[model samples]
Target: MIRKLEGRTWKFGDNINTDLMIPSFALAEPEEKQPKYCFSANRPGWVDLVKPGDILVAGNNFGTGSSRPGAKVLKSLGIICLLAESINGLFLRNCVNYGLPALPCPGVFSSFNEGDIASVQLEEGKVVNLNSGRVLATTALPNMLLEILAAGGIVPLLEGKGLLDKAR
Candidate 1:
């Protein structure tokens, strides 16, 4: 089962490009420092403040910008998945490959402006609009990817079943 994430919320505006998601400049740093710098623009302190299992709600075009790996670098900071009106094709694909969860959720923004607690069911593929008493949208997770997300990102998933050593 996918580990559902639920807790206090944090919000973001529309067209949150990849640069803000994970600034290109941060790629120059070590991998250990990479995930820490995600979302440096729309919410500067968010990368540090977002606790594990906190739900995130964003406005339309949540990821609309250049195709960069930076946007897919936040599994460590604990952004369980993205709930927004729409997402760019490039960003969406990048997130999926990297084991990040990006769901298309149009009405999520209207339900709670931000800072409101919300519940996320990664397997049932739904985000509960807690305040509005509605389920906003379904997640776009493939079966394999759902397992990776359930195990807390890709590396943990691979280590769990011991498939990583096949190449060795």
Candidate 2:
């Protein structure tokens, strides 16, 4: 259920739209190539800079644009989760659908700096700054959502239920 997520934080500011997440020109490319262009237009070389298990921390309205396939790109890049001051509803849903959890926490932006290691405990709804000893609370993930995430996304959950193979 992704009870504990720990990683270095990659901070970004407000209103980072889908285009900035993965530019439209790179949309058609395969997963192997899609990550290279992620944040390329906004933060050049960001993809190469991120390591596996890294957490993305952002300001208000993160992922505030057209609902697109950017979450898939993020998952493929190995981002474990996202903690933000606020996030667009569609984008949050998309991230969850792709098995990348995104949670809103007030003051999260003000609490941690870029590159500070952060640990999120989903069950406790707590985010801790491993570097500074600050902690913040967020909404607890619902059990159903946790189940989907544990399965690595909705498709996998459905597959586990034999729903994907059966005609609806």
Best by lDDT: 2
CA lDDT, every model vs. true structure: 0.70, 0.86
Top-TM-score candidate index: 2
Per-residue lDDT of model 2, residues 56-130, tens digit only: 999999898887777888888889988888989889888888899778888999899899999998767799999
Point out where model 1 deviates above 4 Å.
Answer: 137-168
Question: What TM-score number comes out for model 2?
Answer: 0.93
Check candidate 2 and list the clashing pairs. none
lDDT of 1 at 167: 64
Indicate the residue-level lDDT of 70 in model 1: 48
TM-scores of the models, in the order given? 0.76, 0.93
lDDT of 2: 0.86
